[model samples]
Target: MFGGPYPWSLYCGQWSILPPAPKGNYLKDKVVVITGATSGVGLEASKQFADASPEQLIFAVRSVEAGEKLLGQIRKAHPNLQDKVMYLDLTDLQNIKDFSEAIKVFGRVDILINNAGINPNFDEGPYKSTKDGYERVFQTNVLSPFLTTLLLLPLLRKSSDPKVIFTGSDVHHIAPSDLIETALQNGQSIISAYNDEGKYHNPTRYYESKLLLQILSRNLIKTLPDITTINVNPGLAMTNLGRDFNLSLSPSGIVGILWFVANARSASKAARNLTSAAA
Candidate 1:
C-alpha cells in the first residue's frame, strides 16, 4: 500500500481481516522488548503479545506518561500480562544507549521490535536535526534502530530463540537514488538535501529511511547468524504516523483519507502480521 504493488484483495474492501492472534502461550516466559509500543501498530501488537503471555513485555518509549497509560489499559484488559515501561527517546542517542544498557538487567531478550518511526508530512517545514546532529527522520527511523539492535545483541544471544523485527515500508522501493548517493557521499548526513525545500518531499525522506532500515537488516543477518532478523511492512494502516497531515482541515487531506481507507489495512490487522512475525 505504501507505493508498492500488492494483491488486489488488500485494497478490495471485501477480504476478511485476519483473525486475532491465535490463542496460545507462544511467548510464555519469553522476554519481549518493543519500541514505539505506546500507540498505533505498536500498541496493538503489544496487546497481542500480552495475550500470548510473554514473561516480560518492556516498552521503550519517548513519553513515560503515554507509556504508563498504555500499560494501564493493557493491564486492565489482561491483568496477568507482565508489561513495564522504559524511557527511550530516539531523537537522542544517549537515551538510546541508556535504554539498551538498562535492558541488561532483564538478563535475556527473546524478541526486539524496532517499531518506532516518524513521518513529518508534506507541510512540516525545514528539516530538523536530532540532539546527535543527525537528520531527525534519518536518525529516528534508521540509525537509532541500528544502534539499538547492535547494543542489544549480547542480551539477545542469551535467549534460545532470539528474533529482531524491523518495521519497514513498501515506500522504500521508491527511494530516489540522488538522495541515497548524496547521503552516502556526504558521510551519513541527509540534512542538506532535506533542507532544500524545492526538491524535498516529506514522504521521500521517510521512504529513504525505510530503505536504509532494510539495508541494515540484510547486512545484520550476514554477521549475526545466531539471531533471526526480519524486516516487515505491516501494510498501510490508519495510525498516528500521519499526525502531521492535518487531513480534516484541507481538501487534499480529504482525498488522502479516502485513498488510504480504500487501500490500507487497520492497525489491528497490521498488528496481526507483526505479532505473527515475532512468533
Candidate 2:
C-alpha cells in the first residue's frame, strides 16, 4: 500500500504503460551519446536506443571493461550497429574535460543523455568528497554533468535538433531550503556543508543534488536557446543501486525492498521515458 498522501489505487493507477518500441529507424544516421551506460536505467536506455539503429552509439563510462562488455552484447544483437566506448569518471573534473574533448572528434552529436549518478547508501560511512574537493554526490550528480553539457555544446550545435536529457528523480520535490541554509552557513564548503555526521543521509543528499539539476535544466533553456534540454524522472525501478543494503539482514529491510519490487516499475519500462524524451 502507498504510504504517502496518495491512496494505493491512485499511485498504482499512474504506473506508466510502456510505449511501443520506436518504429522505422527514428535515430537513423544520428550519433547518440550516453554517460553511465554500463548499468541500470542507463544500460536499459542504451538497449532501447540500439534497437532504433543509430549511426553510432557512444558510451561514456568509468570502466572501459564494463563498457566493452555491454558494447559486445549490443553488437551481438545488432551486428551492423556502430558503437564505441569512451572513458568518463564523473567524480574527476579532468576526466569530464578529457571525455568531452574526445567526443568532439565526431562530426555531430544528436543526443546527449546525462544518466550517470551515484546515491551512496546510508551504510556507506560519512560523506565523501570527490577528487575535485567537492562533495561526491554534488559533483557526480550536478557539477560534472553541467560541465559536460557546456563542453559538448559546439558538437551538439552541429545537429539539426540537438537534445540533452538530464536524469532526475521525483525525490527532488523534497524541500531543499535546509540544504541551502546549511551550504550558506558553511560558506559553501562542500565538506562542511555535507559532512555533518549527525545529519548525513545518502538519500537526502541525492535528492538535493537532483533538485539542483532540475533547477539547472530550467535555466538552460534561457542560456542555450537552440538546444533542447529536459530533465526526466524515470520512475523507481529495481537496480544494483540497492546492492549495498542487504535486505535479507533485516525483516524491515526485507519487507521494504519486497514492497518496492512489487510496486516499482522495471528498468526497461522506466527507460522508455528516457528514450522517448531523446526521440
Among these predicted structures, which one has the highest lDDT? 1
Off by over 4 Å in 1: 1-20, 182-201, 248-251
lDDT per residue (tens digit) for residues 1-279 in model 1? 232344453444325566567678899989999999988999899888888889999999999999999988888888888778999999999888888888899999999999999987745457677777777888899989999998998999999999999999766776766876867787875556654556656656787788889888999999899999999878778789988654563675666667777767779888887899987
Best prediction by TM-score: 2
Q: Please list all clashing residue pairs in model 1, or write none if there are none.
A: none
lDDT of each: 0.82, 0.82
lDDT, residue 31, model 2: 96
Candidate 2 matches the true fold with a TM-score of 0.88
TM-score of 1: 0.87
Off by over 4 Å in 2: 1-14, 122-124, 181-200, 246-248
Q: What's the TM-score of every candidate structure?
A: 0.87, 0.88
